[model samples]
Target: MLIKSSKQVSRWRTPKRFPVSRNSGASPASRIEPGVSWPEPEGATRVQRFKVYRHDPESGKNPRIDTYAIDRDKCGPMLLDALIKIKNEIDPTLTFRRSCREGVCGSCAMNIDGTNWLACIRSLDEISEPSTVYPLNNMDVIKDLVGDQTHVLAQYQSITPWLRSKTPAPAGHERLQSPEERKRLDGDYECILCFCCTAGCPSHWWNGDRFLGPAILLQAHRWLVDSRDEATGERLDELEDPFKLYRCHTILNCTRTCPKGLNPGKKIAEIKLMIQQRRS
Candidate 1:
């Protein structure tokens, strides 16, 4: 090659080869042992300690943190697994609620690493070290991780989530709903009632008594958008109250925190339109 200018000689050169794998180029499956962690040389430690919050109401004591150590390499990185190890081996008295162990049951809802999440679905790797778990904020704490959901249940009942059509269906026939109508309620109907949206709403903090919040509004959308329902006008009337509809500040917290990817804000907008159109 011919010699180049000074500027060309000063140019940086990129590396031609990447670093080799540390594990002798072995595939991950070949190295991994089922039900047992891969060897980590001699005297390797794989324990992670979590700073879990604890509170007892009957004793009238303050909330506190209790450290729990769990073997990270043995089980998956799910927070629920850590909790189970803590409960079984570390502290049997530690209190928390979980069911189904899947994301379907909302019983494991709590603040993990300062955000409301279902412990069953939240991986330990996503959380910061020394993670803090607490009962959901703005709700009554029944114990350590359990919340008194009587208020959320009351609001759910206030909106009347079930169908209430003025016309009853014939005994032998079903209420026919077209595919178009079914598609209308798709996004709004997937709510798992995890209460993450409700806990994040500022309107809930101020006027939970009158404002139904996003969960109820989404449930209302499920009914109002259904073509088979004859009580759309009546449901609109109930939602016409300013506090019930306008109290939502469009903060978008409900949509952001929804575990099932439902948009409560969008459903509330539809409710607003139904109320306005019916009045006119």
Candidate 2:
């Protein structure tokens, strides 16, 4: 929704003022600051390679990896910094999902060095040369580095993550619970829904549709254990299917891949235990 007037577009196309840096002869187009040039003479000293996955589903073609050589010194410490730099300086066609520039948004989840991580949180200095990045594994690619999250999101929606009950709340009163009851939400609510846990799980890769997967199951457990939620039995009943609850084979990938350190395996195990206790 860029509603730029014709005048503004013309002005941008033909800038009256061409600010030039005293050092690098950089024009306004590549100015890093008011008068500083991007890739400052001393800034870009070494080369860092990036192998990014590229594919647009709109075009009928096989996906391929594209390599970019970046000036290591020109990039900021984080991996997202290097990506943004590459997009700005080398190739605008390169694309990936990013927002908030912080880990909380959960929008920038992708593989770095063959492991899932939010690019904003992984420091560029920590990784070696020829860093490889890709979208979450085995998912539909809408474009370069962007996966179609429609299916995973739809699965998340199926769980009814919010509290629901046939009973009505008292008028003008809030549902209250003890601090201990609130503690149960700690690990589960902390999940950013980045899909790292589910995407990394071999079991989920095989039984995704039937299993509900770790990310979905983790949030399901969150609502199921809420003190004010009266639908515990209903939630448990829904998750009792063998395929949905038992597909997890404990390869520990879910626990291993979580950037937030959440153990979806543990959460799924609790769900199973809860169901077992109910039956007994």
Top candidate by TM-score? 2
Q: Over 4 Å off in model 2, which ranges?
A: 1-44
**lDDT of all the models against the reference?**
0.72, 0.77
Which parts of model 1 are misplaced by more than 4 Å?
1-44
Q: List the residue pairs that clash in candidate 2.
A: none
Model 2, residue 170: what's the lDDT? 71
Give per-residue CA lDDT, model 2, range 1-280, as digits (tens): 3423211112122232236432254333322222111232345568777877777556555566677777776678888998898888877877899997878888888977766788898877756567777789757678878888898899898888888877788789888889999999999999999998788777877778787889999999999989989999888888888787889777777776777778898899899899889878
TM-score for each candidate, following the candidate numbering: 0.79, 0.82
Evaluated at residue 171, the lDDT of candidate 1 is 89
Error of 1 at 135 (Å): 1.5
Candidate 1: tens digits of C-alpha lDDT, residues 1-280: 2323211111122231236542344344222111212222234266666767676677655555666666677666688888887777667777888998778878788877655778898877766655667777567667778878898888788767787777878789898788888888798777888887887787986788788888878887888888877777777877788798789888876776666667888888878877777668
* Models, CA RMSD each: 15.4, 15.7
